[model samples]
Structures are given as C-alpha cells and as structure tokens.
Target: MELEQFEHTIRKLFNKELLEELDDDYGFTNKSRGSFKTVGYSTNLSLETIESAAENNVELMVTHHDAWDFIYGLKEECLKKLKEYNISHFWIHGPLDFVEFGTCTSLMNVIGIDRVTKYSIYDNGDVPGVGEFNEPIDFNVLVKRMRDELEEPVRMWKNNEKQVKKVGVLTGAGHSSNYIKMALEDGCDTYITGEATLYTIQYAQFAGINLLVGSHTFTEIYGVESLAKKIQELNTAIKIVKLKEDHFELNH
Candidate 1:
C-alpha cells in the first residue's frame, strides 16, 4: 500500500488528536519511501533494528521509540542507512501509550488487571494507569506472573507483605517517583513499570507500595506487536514483521 494511506490509517487507529498533542518526533521521523509492501514493528529504533528491517526487506519501520541519541542530533548513521535501504521510519510514542490496547493497557491485560481505576495524564488527555484485580494476589505470585508473562527479568522492591489488589501500570521507562506517588494516592498497593532507578525504588518503599519492574523493551514490545496485527487487519496485503532486539539483556 502507499505510505501515505498507511500513515493515515495508523493516525486514525491511534487517534489523530492524541498524536497532535505529542512532540513532533512522535510521528514519521523519516519518509524516504513512498510505498511499502512489508512493514516492521519494534519497541525502539536502533542500528540493529534498522539492519534487521533491511535484512527482512521491510520497506517501512513502525517503532515505539525513536533512537535515544536522536535527541543529541546524532542519528545521521541511522538516517543514512534508512535512506540507503529506502525504508521509511515512523514512530508512535505517546499516542500508542494513550490509545486503547496500548502499552499500559496491554501490560495490564497480560497481568490480569480486572478493572481500571485511574489514568496517567498526558498533555491533553489520560491513559489507563491504575487498575485493580478481581481478588487480591500474593506479592510474590504477582511478580512471578509478570516475569513469566513478560519473559524478562523482573527487578522488584518488595515494600511489604501486603496482597496486591489495586495496582498501577505504566510501561516504557515510566518508573518515576511522581508516578509512584500518584499510584499511592490512587490507593494502589502495587505499581508496575518498565524500568526504575534507585530513587524510584526508595520512593516506592517510602510510599509503602510494591514495585514490579521489567526491561524497558520487553514491557513495551507487546503494544508494538499489537499494532502490527492491527495494521495487518487493516490491510492484509501489507506484510507485517515484528522485529526483536536480540542484543538487549538485563543481567541482575
């Protein structure tokens, strides 16, 4: 399909108004191609991901995050490679986080969040953030479920022996103390996010909340994969490939 139509469909799928509220970098980073037969989806744009797209003959790449170094204006190499391969690069960041079946919601579904109680506020709107289980679960049991479902190492701060009932979720580097505080205020006994820092752990402990953290990539990958499926449902003619970052590993 034509890249323009594909992008239009994506915008509609993710809600155009929400996308407009995000930074300019949240959409098509580079449009080197006009059309594509195959599209690749991944959690982030990296040299390795670009190479994999090239190897898979993907004419377009839809990623959850732009290359981090692009903030420093140093993604020239990646840009050159995309140009060389004639691969278009598109990013869906905050919108994906806010959309239905998005990052946080997807993670929540995976871990059995029964009902949504609160949302994380973005610039113009809010997304699912805090939820509750049908019944309280043991903290260790919840951690094991997260580890098994995410298939990634889990780093946790077990603040108490309380059973996890009300829980908050924010995927992809969403482990800020501010979010933790919000969860606590929302009456969540547990909080889950992609990654956390020392301060995040301390704050969760002080706030008396259980914290469950997964690798940044693995936690957010589900949303991208879901997007790929959605795109394929829109246009079955356009092949969708889900790319993996084999190099990313969390060693504790």
Candidate 2:
C-alpha cells in the first residue's frame, strides 16, 4: 500500500481531531518509501530498531517515540542511515497515549485492570488511566504478572498491605507526585508507571498507595504493537515486523 494511504488510515484510526488537540509529533519523519510491502514497529526509534527494520527488509518503520537525542542534534547519523536504507520512519507519540488501544490502556489490560473509573488530566485532555480489577489480588501477584508480561524487572514501593483492586497506570515517564495524588483521589490502592522519582516514591508512601514501576520501553511497547496489528488488519497485503530492543540493558 502507499505510505500516504497508510498514514491517513492510522491518523483516522487514532482520531485526527484528538491528534491535533494533543499536538502530537506524528506522521512520517522520512518519506522514502512511496509504497511499502512490509512495515516495522517498535517503541522507540533507536539505532538498533532502525538496523533491525533494515535487516527485516521493512520499507516503513513505525515507532512510538522519536530519537529524543534529536534535541541535542544527535540523530543526524540515524536519519542518514534511514535515508540510506530508503526506510520511511513514522512516529505517533502523545496521541497513542490516550487512544482507545493506547499505551496506558494496553498496560492496564496486561496487568488485569478492568473498568476504567477515573481519569488523569494532561495537556491534551482527561486520560483514562485509573481502573479497577474484577477482584482484588495480592500485590506480589500483580508484581509477578507485570514482570512476566513486560519482561522487565519490577520495582515496588510497598506503602500499604491492601489487596490491589483499584489501579492507576500511566506508561512511559508518567510517575509524578501529581499523578499519584490523582490516583489516590480516585481511590486506587495500586499505581503503576514506567519509572519513578524520589519525590514520587515519597508521595505514594505518604499517600498510602502501592507503587509499581517498570522500564519505559517495555511498558510502552504494547501500544506500538497494537498499532502495528491494527495497520496489518486494515491492509492485509502489507506484512508487519516487530523490532525489539532491550533498552534497560547495562552492557554497551
């Protein structure tokens, strides 16, 4: 399918009005592929992900986050590589965070969150991030599920001994004291996010809410994967490949 049609379909799927409201940095960064037979998806536009896309013979690369180092003018090499490989790179950042099958909602589904009962306010609008389980489960059990599903080490700040029924989830760098407070207000006993700061931990402790943290990449990958699946469903002729990377690895 043509890249223009693919991008248009995705924008419609994600809601064009919502994307505009969120001011998302979406659409193609590189437009080398006018038509693509295979597409690649990943959580971020890392060097490894780009290389994997090229290796998999992907003509279009879809990522959740752009190379953030671009702010420091560090993405020239990666951009050059994409141009060299003739791989089109597209990113859908903030819009995917609040979409129906978005980052926060996907994480909630993975961790067994049921009905969404609360929302967290952001620059775009109220995000449906707080929910409840059908039945309360032990905190340790939830931790195990997160580790198994996300395939990342889990960090916990156990502030209460209550079974985790109500939960608030904000994927990818959403662990702020304000979010914790919103969760507490929503009566969520457990709060999950990508990473946490000292102030966030202390706030959760004082507010008596359980805090569970995972790596940013793992927590947000589900959304991009979902997007890829949706795209493939829309265009059966195009193949989709997931470009995986372990951003949490310590070794260079």
The number of the candidate with the highest TM-score is: 2
Off by over 4 Å in 1: 70-74, 123-128, 247-249
lDDT of 2: 0.83
Cα RMSDs of all predictions?
2.2, 2.0
Residue 193, model 2, lDDT: 88
| Residue 113 displacement (Å), model 1 | 2.1
- Report residue 135 deviation for candidate 2 (angstroms): 0.8
TM-score of 1: 0.91
Which residue pairs collide in model 1, if any? none
Q: Can you write out model 2's per-residue Cα lDDT over 84-114, one digit (the tens) per residue? A: 9999999998878878788887888777777
Q: Give the total clashing residue pairs for model 2.
A: 0
Give one digit per residue, the lDDT tens place, for model 1 in 42-72.
9988888999999999999999998777366
At residue 149, candidate 1 shows an lDDT of: 86
